[model samples]
Target chain A: MARIVTFFIMLVFWVLISGMFDAFHLGVGVICCLLVAIFSHDLLFYGHPDLLWVRDIFKVLAYFPWLFYQIVLSSLEITYIVLHPRMLEIIDPRLVRFRTRLRNTMARVTLAQSITLTPGTITVNMSGNEFTVYALTQKAAEGLPGEMETRIARALERE
Target chain B: MRELQEEAKLRMPWQDVILQTSVRVLIPFIQLFGLYVVVHGHYSPGGGFQGGVILGAAIILMALVFGLPASKHYISENVNKTLSITGPLVYCGIGALCILFGGYFLDYSALNRILPLGPIAWRSFGIFLVEVGVGIGVMSIMLRIYRVLSSAGTIDQGL
Candidate 1:
């Protein structure tokens, strides 16, 4: 099975890279590998139905660097808001729901996680096509379902 | 022969089964890395807890690749239950031992005299064991929660 093969390849790659082939430590490595194999069996077996194409995998990977940049930018903005004396006057917190175009579970989950990582936006709840998001500012909430939803839709090729 | 072939057909796909085997093969190296992280946690950026989770994740990864049944075959539910309890028991036992030596609960300094070794020499080992226990408890509980919730189809269906 692909699952078992992936597990073995990952282990072999790890051993080759880590060079943990010492005599006494070999037993420990074996035990650890066994545990990994035990836990990860489902992923290997299922192979993520949502990730049917290589392009989908690449798309998800490509989103990470951009997501990190967004996180940094938002963190700085949050820091500035926190340092300001009249922070409460500029900040508005409320829950707003919007529909998303992404149909795949993985893409939606990634979007939620990405939004949560960014300051000023927190995903409160998600049900079907609707997402309840908490935003610190209305400006932050304005494009709620547009930019992020578009990006995730693109990543998932779901339109 | 036809009936037997049909039963085999009902099993998971060949690709998935291969992936599961591969994941199992790879577990040894990931585990060693986890151990390295655990042992050097105090001096480096990681610790026992991180390593333990990584180790657990490796297994969980295999489970994801293989079917739940195969994964359960590799790591029985009983073993998980035992590990879930054993970690806390070990931690508590260590604390009790410290108390017996007339030191505060979890005081490692008191353990030196009991072990026929120097205090500083044994303290690191004591801390290492404690961290292992904590890691085991946390990892088992997290995995168990995931398994239970997923089996109940609550989280999976919601996703």
Candidate 2:
């Protein structure tokens, strides 16, 4: 019931957004919506939005761009280090674990993805709110869950 | 162990809910945007391959947030099966058509006259249909892969 309503709402929203009011196109859209609905109807009732606290959602959005910038910088640094001939001498691959204060699954996943995107660090395991990370250098491994951790916590309102 | 069980408790079951309200409401727009991507692929950065992946990802997101069963209900196995074949079939058919027109295989420029439009815009219409075919094929294959992997139990248990 709720799924059907959501589908109709989405269909109407799509029609409006696309300005596709032609009978043929609208008919096709409706049919496709029904088809998709028939297949996906079971998805209507699983997760609850109650877990998401919107108060911090926007904060994370704001933080993401900055995080992306850091990711780019780190990627460049890693790329340069990898391209350098003395890369093996510089490489100090080690695994480090740290407990994060961020409580939300979404925040943790985002943080993990960002870390992986940064090139030097790869998130191997996240268990019991503890993250196991593989870092290329000792310097890179140390003090993690440091400033970035605090920033993510702030963004997620985990504190 | 307690924490793990508690985390496990956080997992929702089938019949716990129906379809995703957001996906139901948003799919039309996503599909429309996907169509746009398919149509404009030649002139822009996105081609049939990229657009198809995005479309599949959107549906997958709907499946993840909603439920796999629900997504299957919406997309269906038969349709996806046909789609998987359709991409290669279309590519091959187009190539054959080009051969019939006394051109090389897969030369889409030969089909321009089929639309009754201006001089065959090979980059636009020819590439557009090929892209659409590719998108449909890729999307179906990806969805099938998701189904196979999700059913394997490891996806949910490990994640």
Candidate 3:
């Protein structure tokens, strides 16, 4: 079942990109896609068998808009800090440590990437549940692993 | 068993919930974009090699973040070895097919007899096929090199 789905997805992707529509092109696409699907289906869908796949897909889709908004907000904040006259004084760079409730590897990674993607904070290192983050300002570092962690946890929660 | 235990003990310093979650979310998109690059080479700046490298990097990123053992579960050493050969073989096979069809090496227009797509269309379609082959080959080779290098020529231990 997964193999068939993968083949169709690959075929659609191939047709969409190729745009030739000639019988020959379509034939090649089908053949190539089938070959790939047969060999690589497991790689495509490896791990995370517990979650409802459809629901998780939608959950991730819903999370993107919120993440983009957060990115914009942080970019603006970083720009303001960079342009400030007392930039050195305001930029109290510090490292913060925190642990999250999220247990799934995927969820944990998403939260870490979210932190790094947001302008003010960078995830310096991570081990098990704990994260060491570098923040550009004292204020940015203040609420370590707060809203973003919770939001990602919610987005990827198994239940 | 003792060596395996020692390897396990040489752990990365930190792991956070956020990093794990984000990588899971991002890897699929990264691979999809890589495929897009490979397929849209005619219309885009990217081509087979670039797209293949991107795909390989996605897997490498997974290995780096999640550890080598976890990645092997997705793409085992045996499968990787086979794929490394299969990609180039696909590319060369197409070329050889063109030759058997009575055209010069890599001459895609010769494929018209087999598919009736006109000489010009066949040529374009031929390029697409070659690109796909190249993409696969490059992706596997890159992954193979990274795997060997990180593990110090062994499939286990090291990174």
**CA lDDT, every model vs. true structure:** 0.68, 0.66, 0.77
lDDT of 2 by residue, B1-159 (tens): 445346446754322111234455456557656655554565556877877887887777767766676566667778788889999888778778878876678776666656645545563556656777888888888877887787684333211
For model 2, the stretches where C-alpha displacement exceeds 4 angstroms are A1-57, B1-32, B35-159
lDDT of 1 at B80: 89
Cα displacement (angstroms), candidate 3, residue A156, comes to: 4.0
- Model 1: CA > 4 A from native: A12-31, A43-55, B1-159
lDDT of 2 by residue, A75-115 (tens): 88788887999888988999887888777665676677667
For model 2 the interface RMSD, in Å, equals 7.3
Q: What is the TM-score of each candidate against the true structure?
A: 0.51, 0.49, 0.66
**Best-matching candidate per lDDT:** 3
Give per-residue CA lDDT, model 1, range B31-150, as digits (tens). Answer: 557666764565566776787788677666655775456556766788989999998998999999999998888888899878766888668768877877877887677667767766
Q: In terms of lDDT, which candidate is stronger, 1 or 3?
A: 3
Poorest stretch of ten by lDDT in candidate 3 chain A: A42-51
Clashes of each: 49, 17, 21
Which ten residues in a row are the worst by lDDT in model 1 chain A?
A42-51
Q: Rank the candidates by TM-score, best first.
A: 3, 1, 2
Better of 2 and 3 by DockQ: 3
List A-chain TM-scores for all predictions.
0.77, 0.71, 0.86
